[model samples]
Structure formats: structure tokens, C-alpha cells
Target: MLDLALEIAAELIRRPSVTPEDGGCQDYIEALLQPYGFRRIRIDRGGVTNSIFLRQGERAGCLAFAGHTDVVPTGPLIDWPHDPFAAVVENGMLHGRGAQDMKGGIACWLAASIRLLRDGVPIPTMQLLITSDEEGESIDGTIHIVKHLQSHGMLPDAALVGEPSSHRIVGDTVRRGRRGVMQVRIRFDGKQGHSAYPQDADNAIHRAIPALHRIIDLDWGNPAAGFPATTCQITNLNGGTGASNVIPGHCDAFLDIRYNPANSADEIESMLRNACNAEHVQLEFDRVADAFATPDGPFLDSVTRAIRDTMGIEPRLDTGGGTSDGRFLAKAGIPVAEIGLTNATIHQIGECVALEELAALSAIYASLIRNFEVNG
Candidate 1:
């Protein structure tokens, strides 16, 4: 099983799939699963590639594993010890761009599923949801797959997202929820004039300072349990006109807010509206990702039990990540848990993962699949 996972992971890492490109990763996955009776359903849209590999089971209930084939852009090639797309394995580590972030997780899941099938183990129907639009704008990725499942009445009883959620060891931590994301673009307008005469120039920067201060001071209240307080950051601000002597006519600011379930997007927008209430100020809000949580139940119990049984350690049920494709699955009313390889090196220049992690994660996934039961 470990060798199978390593081979698959190495092949996927060598594909050079950056951002919205699949790099033929999905095609390889289809070929691998086709022989195992898993049928692929394509949900391509807006240039994004999405696929659902479904296999009917002899047992009751359905299980789904959601993952992405896309990886973030590799940084400076000279900075990396090995080529980012080479999938180097040395000193017990698998080094590559997606080794920890995602492709590794997907490979482990596939290994576990295939191994179980080869052993003739009776398992629930399985669905592997793969997309190539995760690391980029996720407008037409898993969300589209979920919509298709809903329309076809094939929603799974539960889903496990392969998002590299572990901290120290594989199976040591599983993400039960993630904070929401809201990006704001604020434009402040004023009359541009000479800076020499304050009376002749309306300083838009001056008008923006106080309003931005209010936004920073806005109370987001307390966060929900197992979650952190909401955070708002002014990521970008520009107001100067090239000439040091001239006052800017307009100021542009960008805000990135990460909020827990304690605050809804609507409420946050309202608060921002009140803060920047001037007629000249315009605010555009985009609810990029909505906060979601999977309450403790049979589904979570099964996940924890699988980890404990396989890894011989108590798993920490955490809710402290920026955001993930799991939110889309969770929003569809399915119990969702993110369980995967350790994420210590995700998105780093020399991103890598221990080969042992692949084996352990594959074992945990196999255990989970063997003992999974739908939560009422």
C-alpha cells in the first residue's frame, strides 16, 4: 500500500499542475480507478476540471473523499533543493510542491481504497471528488460537483476532505471546521487639488484614516468554541498621487477578514458599512468562503476512532485553518472532516513529507472506510 501511494504521489507531483491546471492528473486518476469499477463523472465548467469517481459497494451507506489536484505555484527554481516537479524521495522524505498540501493526501486515499478493494473487503459505496480549481479562484470547482450531486440526489452520507490537516504526525489532528473569508475593496473619492493649499484640496487619505480606524475597532464579538476570534486586516492601501506636493483625490484600500461562525457575512458587511458611512466612500464585499462546522456525532466519532485505532494516538479535533474546499462539502448538509498528511511544510519552497506519513495516512483512511457508518 505504501509503495502504491508513493508511486501515485510521485506521478502526480511530476505533473506540474499549478493553480487551475490539472496537468493530466485527473486523467491518470481515471485510468487507475477505471479497472476497479469506479466510473468517472466529469463536471468541467468555466475552464475548471472537476471529476467524480464513483464505485458502488455491496454494503450500506456512501462515503466520499474530496480533494484537489491543483497545487500552488512553485517559487524560485534556484531556491529549491530539488526541482519542485521532480517528486524527489530521499532520506525518508517525499519532496515536491503538493507533497503535503494536497496531492499526497489524495494519493493516500486512493491507495487505501484500492488496497481494500483488492482484499475484497466489503465497504460502503465510495466517491472521490477531484477538482483542479482549488489553489486558484474556486468559483467552479467542488461547488459545481456538489450542485451536480444535489441535482442527481447522490449526496454522500459523509465526506472526508484531503486537506493536509495534521500538525505533527499523520492522524494527530483532524480539522472539523474552518474560519470564513470575506474580502473588501474600499474606494474613497475626493477632489484632487494642490497640497500647498489645504482649503483647495479635499484630502481623501484624511477622510479614510478615521473610517479605517473604526473598521479596525469594530467588535466581532466572541468566537465559537474550538475557534479563534474574528480577525480583520488591511492588506493593501494606496493614496498618494506620484507628486509629493499633490494631495490624492482618491484612496483605495483592500481588507481581508477571517471570521468564525460567531459572525455572519451579512452582519460583518453591515458593520463595515457603518464604519465607512461617507457618501464618497464605496465598499465592495465578497463573501469568498463561508464558515462551517461539523458537530460531534457518529461521523466524527468514527473518524476519531479510526485515527486512534490506526495511529495509536488520540486525535485532536481542531477548527483553526484559513479555509478549504471542505467548506463546500460541509455547506451541502453532509458531515465533513478533514483528515490527511502532516501539513508542516505545505506551500513552502522546500515542501516535503515523510514517507512514513503516507503509510500511516493510508492505514487510517483504510480503517475509516472499513468501519464507517452514516450518522443520523
Candidate 2:
């Protein structure tokens, strides 16, 4: 299994599967799964690459594992200690792009599946959903995959997303859920006039200032679990087109909201609408991901027990992060949790993973699978 882990990670790194590009990363995974008895399903919708492979069991519900193969671009390759694609193992760490953020995770799953198959274990059905569009818009990855699952009745009872959730140790933390994300583009409209004649026309920037303060002042983090309330921040702004003398006709700002579970999407949308007022400002929102809370039920209990039994410590339940593919699966009401390697180096040049954690995570996954069968 360790050999498989190392090999797969290197092979995956060789492919430059950046956001929204498969880069043959999914194809490499399918090749490994095919030899092991898992049925690979390539799900492409509207030019998106999301592939799923399943190994059916004689029993009932499915145990699903979700992850992405896409890696963020390796910026200024010279910063890396070794070739990001070479996948050098230096000082007990396998260094490469996507080593920690993902590929490491996918490798662990592959290793676990191999061990499970070799053990002749007979239990619930298992599924693996992999996509390469996570670092981008994420619209074509897990979102479309979940929709495909629903239409064909492939929704799993529970899912484990292989996101780099642990802050320090491998199981030190687990993400129970993620805050919903909304990227808003607002355009404040006003009549262009001379800067000297202040009363001739409205200044869009001046009108936008108050609304910006209102948005900045809203609480985004939740009180419970240290989760902040609906977090709103202005990411970018543009008004005048170079000439200082001109009063711009339009002022634009990009706002990002990471809202908590306490508010619905409609509620947040209404907040934006009301704040914009009728000042001719156009408020447009494009949802990146929805907020999902993990249930404290049998599924979670089983995973928690498995982690404690293996690591001798209970993992912390966290809700901090931009988003994960789990966002889509959680929409089905399945309890979702993230478990993976340390995330300190993800998306960075010379990204790496501790080799020991790779082996440990694989064993941990296998143990969890066994525990799920026994507890179920």
C-alpha cells in the first residue's frame, strides 16, 4: 500500500492538472482502480471533468469518498527546492504540487482500496468521486457530479472528503462543515460631472462608501464553535478611469461573503438587496458553494471512534476553510467530514507531505471502513 501511495503520488504530480483541467490525472486514477475491480464512471457535463469509480458490495448503502485531482498553478518554479513534477523524496517528505492539498489524499484512498480488496472484505458498497475543477469555479466538478449521482440514483449515505483538514497532525482536526460562499459584483451608477462642480452630478464612489462600510461591518462568523458570522469583505474596487478630474459614472466593487448556517441564501441575498438600496447600483451574486453542517449521528460517531482508536486522541470539529468538494455532497444531507495530510504547504511551490502520514492515513481509512461495517 505504501508503495502504491508513493507511486500514485508521483504519477499524479507528473500531470499538470491545474484548476478546470483534467491533465489526465483522473485517467491515471481510473487506470489503477480498473485493475482492482472498481467500476470507473467518467462524468463530464458542460466540458467539466468529474470521474467516479465504484466497487459494489452485496449489502446495502454506499460508502463514498470524494476528492479533487486539480492542483493550483506552481508559481515561479524557481522557488521550489526540487522540481515540483520530479516528485523528489527529501528528508522523509514527498515534495510536489498537490502532494498535500490532494494527490496525497487520492493516493491514500487508492492504497486503502487495494488493501480492502486484498483482505477479501465483504461489506457495503464503496464509491470514489474525483474531479479536477476544484481550484477554479468548482461549478463543473462536484456540483455536476452530485447532480449526475442524483439523476442516476448514486447518492451515498455518507461521505468523507479528502481535503487537507488537519492543521498539525494527520487527525488533529476534521472539518465538519464549511461556510457558504457568495461572490458579489456591484456597480454603483452615477452621472459623470466635473470634479470641480460637486453639485452637477452624483459621485458613484461617494455613494458606494457608505454601503461598503455597512457590508464591512456585518458579522460573518458564528458565535458557536468560534465560527464567525456572515463574513463580508471587499476584494476589489474601481471607479475613475485614470483621469482625476472626472467624476466617474460607475464605481464597481467585488464583495465576498462567507456566511454561517444561521442564515439562508435567500436571507443573505435580501441583505445585499436592501443594502444596495435604489441608488441604481446593480447587485449580482454568484454562489461559489453552500454552507453544510455535519450531523452528530452514527456516521460521525463511527469515524470519531475510528480516529481515536487509531490515534489515541479525539479530533477537533472545525468549520474554517474556503470550501471543499464536500460542499456539494453535503447538500444531500449526508454527514460529511474531511480527513487528510497536513495542509501547511498546499498550493505552494515545493508542496510536500510527510510519508509516515501517508501510510497512517491509509491504515486509518481501512480501519474506518472496518469499523463502519462492524458498527453498521
Candidate 3:
């Protein structure tokens, strides 16, 4: 199992599929699964590659594994210990850009599925939802696939997102939920004038300061259970012209808010508008991702059991993380759990994962598939 996973991970890393570009990664995946009785369904859009590989089972329900083939850009060739796309393995670590975030995870899932079939294990209907737009705009990624499944009444009972969710070990942690992201751009308008003529022009900076203070102090209520409190930060602020002698006519501020389910986008937007009460101020809010939590139930219990059975460790059910494609599945009323290799070096220059960790994760995924029951 480990050897097969390593081979697939190496092949995937060799492709420089950055952001929205698949770089032939999906084609490679399709080729691998087609021989295993999996049928490929293409749902590409906006130049983004999305495919669903479905393998019918002798069992009753369908199970889906969601993942991405694309990776973030490599920062600099000189900075990396090995080529980011080289998939080098040394000292038990697989080194590359997507090793942990997460070509490695996808490899583990495929390896487990292949092993199960070869061993004559009774498995449920399986679906591999692969997308290349995860690291970019995400406008035409898994969401579209979920829509297609929904229209055809083919939604799985649950889904396991192959993100690097573990922290210290392969099965030490799993994310049952994620906080939502909201971004705002606020622009304050004022007449420009010479600094010496204070009475002739209103200072945009002066107008922005008190409102920003109000925004900073606005009350966001207590957080939801099993999640962190809502957080709002003024990420960027620009007010003055380069010339100190000029009172700027415009001031711009950007806010990044990560909110728990306790606060809705509507409530947050209303509060910001009321706080920046100046008529000349303009506020634009983009609810980038919606907060979602899968309540504790059979699906979660099965995942925890699989981790404990495979690695002898009771995993932490966490909700802390940046937004992910899991939000889309959760929004569609499907229970989602994120599990995979350790995320110690995800999105870093020296990003890599231990070969043993990949093997352990593959075992865990195999356990999940073997023991999964839709009505459990």
C-alpha cells in the first residue's frame, strides 16, 4: 500500500498544476482509476478541470472522497531544498509543493481504494470528486460537482475531504467544521485641499479614524460551541497622499472577518454600516465562505473509530482552520469530515510528509471504507 501511494504521490507532484491549472494531473488520475472499474464524468467549466470517478459497489450506499490536484505556487526555486515539483524522497520524507497540502492525501485515498478492491473487501459505492480550482478562485470547483450530483440525486451519504487535517500525527486530528470568511472594503470620501487650509476641506483621514475606532470596538456576540469566537481585523488602511501638505480626498480600509455560526453576514454588515455612519462612506461586503459545522453523529463516530482502530489514537474533533472546499459540501446538507496526513509543512517552502505518515493515513482510509455503514 505504501509503495503504491508513494508512486502516485510522486507522479502527482511531478505535475506543476498551480492554482486553476490542472497541468494534466486530472488526466493522469482518470487513467489510473479507469482500469479499476471507475467511470469518469467530466464537469469542467471556466477553464477549470473537475471530474468525478464513480465505482459501483456490491453494497447499498455511496461514499465520496473529495480532493484537489492543484497546488499553490512555489515561492522560489533557489529557496527550496529540492525542486518543488520533483517529488524527492529522502530521510523518509516526500519533498515537494503538494506533498502535504495535499497530493499526498489524494495518493493515500487512491491507494486504500485499490487495496480494498484487490483484497476482495466489501465496499460501498465510491466516488472520487477531484477538482483543479481549489487553490484559486474556487468559483467552478467542487460546488459545481455537488450541484450535478444533487440534480441527479446521487449525493453521497457523507464525504471525507482529503485535506491535511492532522497536526502531530497522521490521525491525530480531523476537522468537523470551519469558520466562515467575510471581507469588506470601505472607502471614505472628502474634498482635497492644502493642509494649511484646514477650514476649506474636510480631512478624509480624520473622518475615517473615529469610524474605524467604532468598527474596532463593535460588539460581536459570544462564539458558537466547539468553535472559536468571531474575529474581525482591519487588515489594510490607506488615507493620505504621499505629500504631507495635502489633505487626502479618499481613505480606504479593508477588513477581514472570520466569524463563527453565531454571527451571520447580514448581521455583521448591518453593524459595520451603522458604525461608519458617515453618508460619504461606502462599504462593500463579500461573504467569501459560509461557516459550517457537522453536528456530532454516526459519520463522525465512524471516522473517530477508524482512526483509533488504525493508529490507536483517539483523534481530536476540531473546527479550527482556514476555509476549505468542505464548506460547499456542508452547505449542500451532506455531512463532511476532513482527514489526512499531518499538516506540519503545508503551504511552506520545504513542504513534505513522512512516508510512514502516508502509509498510516492510507490504512486509516481503508479502515473507514471497510467499516462504513450509511445507517450506522
Candidate 4:
């Protein structure tokens, strides 16, 4: 199982699938699972590649694994010890761009399923939801696959997102929820003129200061249990001319808010509008990803038991992280748990994972699949 996982992970990393591009990775996946009786269902949308691989089970209930084939851009290739897409194995580590963020996780799940099937294990029906739009806009990836499942009434009983959720060790942590994302683009308008002629100029920078301060001062209140408090940050601010003597006519400010379930996107938008109350200021709000949490239930208990049996350790149920494709499934009312390899180097220049981590994670996934149950 370890050898199979390492081979697949290396092959996947060899494909340079930078955001929104499958780069033939899913095609490769299809070829691997086709011989194993898994039917491939394509759900491509807006040029993003999405696939659902399904296999009927000998046991009752359906289990799904959600993952992405896309990887974030490798900034400054020279900084990496090995080529970002080479999949180099050095000192027991598989080094590459997607090694830890996702592709490694996907490989482990595949290995586990295949091993179980070959060994004649009677596991539940399985669905592998793969998408290429996660590392980019995330507009037309898992969201479309989820909609298709809903239309066909084929939604799985539960889903495990392969998002590299663990921190220090495999099975040490599983993300039960993630905070919501809200982005706001605010434009403060005013007349542009010379700095010397202060009376003639309606400085946009001057107009933006008070409103920004008000936004920063807005109360977010306490967060929900096992979650962090709502955080609003002014990520970007631009309002200047080339000449120091010029007073800018407009200032654009971008706000990125990660809030727990305690705060709704609508509530945050309302508070923001109240802060930037001037008629000259225009605010555009985008509810990127809604906050979602899977309450403790049979699904979670099963995952915990599988981890305990495989790793001999208690796994922490965490709700931290920016966001993930799991939100789409959670929004569809399916219980979602994110369990995967450790995330020490995800999105870093030298993103990689240990070979042992893959082996352990694969074993845990195999156990989870063998023990999955449906709510009757």
C-alpha cells in the first residue's frame, strides 16, 4: 500500500496542474480506477475539470472522499531544494508542490480503497469527488459536482475531505469545520488636485481614513465553540499618485473577513455598510465561503474510532483553517470531516510529506472505509 501510494503521489506531482487546470491528472486517475469497477462521471464546468468516481459496495451506505488536483503556484522556483513538480524523494520525504496540500492525501485514499478491494473487503459504496478549481477562484469545481449529486439524489451519507488537516502527525487532528470567508472592495471617491491647493482638493485618502478606522473598530463579538473569533483585516489599500504633490481622487480598500458561525455574512456586510456610511464610498461584498460545522454524531464517532484503532492516539476535533471544498458538501447537509496528512509545509516553497505519513494515513482511511455506517 505504501509503495502504491508513493508511486501515485509522485506521478500526480509530475503533472504541473496549477489552479483550475487538471493537467491530465484526473485523466490519469480515471485510468487507474476504471480497471477497479469505479465508474467515472465527469462534471466539467466553466473550463474547470471535475470528476466523480463511484463504485457500488457489498455493504450498506455510501462514503465519499473530496479532494482537488490543482496546486498553488510555486513562487521563485530557485528557492526550492528540488524542482517543484519533480516529485523528488529524498531522506524519506516526497518533495513537490502538491505533496502535502492535497495530491498526497488523494493518493493515500486511492491506495487504501484499491488495497481493500483487492483484499476482498466488504466496504460501503464509495465516491471520489475530484476537482481542479480549488486553488483558484473555486467558482465551478466541487460546487457543480455537489449540485449534480443533489439533482440525481445521489448525495453521499458523509464525506471526508483530503485537505492535509493534521498538524504534527497523521491522525493527530481532523478539521470538523472551517470559518467563512467574506471579501469587501470599498472605493472612496473625491476630487483630485494639488497638495499645495488643499482647499481645492477633496482628498480621497483623507475621506477613507475615518471610515477605515470605523471598520476596524466594529465589534465582532465572541466566536462559537472550537472556533476562532471573527477577524476582519484590511488586506490591501491603494490611494496615491506618482507625484507626492497630488491628492488622489479615489482610494480602494480590500477587506478579508474570516468569521465563525457566530457571525453571518449578511450581518458582517450590514456592519460594514454602517461603518463606511458616506455617499461617496461604494462597498461591494462577496460571500466567498460560508462557515460550516459538522455536529458530533455517528459519522464523527466512526472517524475517531478508525483513527484510534490505526494510530493509537486521540484525534482533536478542530475548526480552524481558512476554507476548503468541504464547505460545498457541508452546505448540502452531508456530514463532512477533513482527515489527511500533516500540513507542515502546505503552500510553502518546499511543500512535501514523509513517506511514513502517507502509509499511516492510507491505513487510517482503509479502516474508516471498512467501518463506515449509514444512519438508518
The candidate maximizing TM-score is: 3
Best-fitting candidate, measured by lDDT? 4
Better of 1 and 2 by lDDT: 1
Between prediction 3 and prediction 4, the one with superior TM-score is 3
Judge candidate 1 against the unseen true structure and give its global Cα lDDT, from 0 to 1: 0.92
TM-score of each: 0.84, 0.82, 0.86, 0.82
Lowest lDDT sum, 10 consecutive residues, model 2, at 218-227
Question: What is the per-residue lDDT of model 1 for residues 274-334, given as tens digits with 9 covering 90 to 100?
Answer: 9998889999999888998888789999999998998899999999877888898888999
Decide which is better by lDDT, 1 or 4.
4
lDDT string, candidate 3, 77-173, tens digits: 8999999999999999999999998899999999999999988988999999999999888889999999999999999999999999998988899
Residue pairs whose backbone atoms clash in candidate 2: 220-228, 220-229, 220-230, 220-231, 221-228, 221-229, 222-227, 222-228, 222-229
Candidate 3 residue pairs that clash? none
TM-score of 2: 0.82
Error of 1 at 65 (Å): 0.6
Better of 1 and 2 by TM-score: 1
**Candidate 4 Cα outliers beyond 4 Å, as residue runs:** 76-79, 184-222, 232-256, 271-283
Residue 132 Cα positional deviation in candidate 1, in Å, after optimal superposition: 1.8
Mark the regions of model 1 whose C-alpha exceeds 4 Å error after superposition. 76-80, 185-218, 233-255, 274-281
Cα lDDT tens digits, model 2, 74-191, are 9998898988878899898998999998999989888887877778776578889888888888878888888988989878888899988888888888888888888999999998
Per-residue lDDT over 327-361 for candidate 4, one digit per residue giving the tens place of the 0 to 100 score = 99999999999999999999999999999999999
